[model samples]
Target: MKFYKHAANGFKIVLERKITMHTTEETVVSFRRVSKIFNKKIMALQNFDLEVKDGEFISFLGPSGCGKSTALRMVAGLEKASEGEVQVFNEQPKEVISNTNDVAFVFQDANLLPWRNVLDNVVLPLELRGENKQESRDKAIDVLEKVGLKGHLKSYPRQLSGGMKMRVSIARALAAKPKMLLMDEPFGALDEMTRQTLQMDLLHIWEREKTTILFVTHNVYEAALLSSRIAVMTAGPGRLSALIDVDLPRPRELSIRTSNEFMKYVETASNHLENGSIGRELG
Candidate 1:
């Protein structure tokens, strides 16, 4: 039997077709005819619908004002959907928000507290939950090592570089071991080299942890590089434009971006963005 890597679950196995017979996986997040409006007038999203499977990396890709971030906020329970339904783990977003282990968010900014050193920053969530001090620290150290920050645990946020700060931010997110990760352009502010570095680290972390990720990005190449499927959106009064499946080989590397297959997916995404068709068929 040949080896196969399941992209959604990041699983490797050698098996025959019998064992690989299709089995339905659990849905981690669902948006059914979802719509979001701000201040009763601004239509940030309309008729958006999608289902995210366990351990899938899905990206909401669109230009500014297209509700990519708005949809992400709904999943994080930071914003309410004005119409339709938003569910996480089959429960309303509000229901899961109370459980710290259910969802975690990473934003454009690292948002690390200056007073707390690297280790403490990562441990803050567990500490606030009243976990045992030593246990919380141990967990923090483990995650810090995953992000290549074990040696710098004593460094304060002020002392860290921009990329390092983001690494600490990611370690903090992983420390909680949340079921789903919602990142709103987390590397948008970093330099190109640094952003690519973090992208690789994030992929490795995802492969090992097998966490479902909902990432919002305006960059087409970034989306194609990291996502299993991309939900391309229309400009303001946002709507789903196309759902392009990036069928690039699994355990992807930065070099894949230079490949013809990768560029084909990128071009498809760009075409959808340029044409801006609302509710275009999935590609």
Candidate 2:
């Protein structure tokens, strides 16, 4: 394959001739010197700066306690930044949190209600929003089908496998049809085979829905496979260490993991991750 290079924000970017990932100049999320402190004692993030473009899939790859989840929570309006600013859709996250159509979050756990069936769990968000009953049910069914859970609509959380439960959780998020999905290790708990399957499923859903995604993953391979860019963070008092652009061709298959190009991307990300951790220790 042919290759070309370009520069943006002082960083070099390389792309393959067949690269198909699409992101616009329009900024969807921005963090300017943002920081997060818990109880005024512990600092989770410091001087974190990032810009997420429209339709981009970005992953946070860092060691544990690097505040990846904290950053995501701030984007979700579940946590407030102690310093600087965080903007989602060009507005303060707090300003848009009330608008259900703007953001959706999928956690590591399915967090499904045991008493509710699959369809009911998926429909719950719309219900809480006081949306029309029939429309909500229809949307739920549609998203459930998208996640390959149509036939299991009546199944309870207890009856499904770990992967299936996560699918239901994702379906619940997608049913809202949000403009962006904030996923915090949504597939980290599953087995390797199941994680690969769901990773493919997620890519398909992302391509079809055209939804921007902010994913957090500890797995370098997963980050390289799923992200348009991977943000490597330093250990505690987490900050941006490197923002590695993943220029892999889109519609990626599992087999791509073994490709030289993909391995190179993984190596780059892994190096950044290790350096970031070491830098924190030295500081």
TM-score of 2: 0.91
The C-alpha stretches of model 1 lying farther than 4 A from their native spots are 1-24, 279-283
User: Tens digits of per-residue lDDT for model 1 on 129-223?
Assistant: 89999999999999999999999999999999999999998999888899889999999999999999999999888878888889999999999
| lDDT (Cα) of model 1 | 0.83
Count of residue pairs whose backbone atoms collide, per candidate: 0, 0
Clash pairs, candidate 1, are none
Shift of residue 139 alpha carbon in model 2, Å: 0.7
Query: Cα lDDT for residue 158, model 1?
Result: 90
The top-ranked prediction according to lDDT is: 2
> Distance from true position, residue 71, model 1, in Å?
0.5
The C-alpha stretches of model 2 lying farther than 4 A from their native spots are: 1-20, 277-283
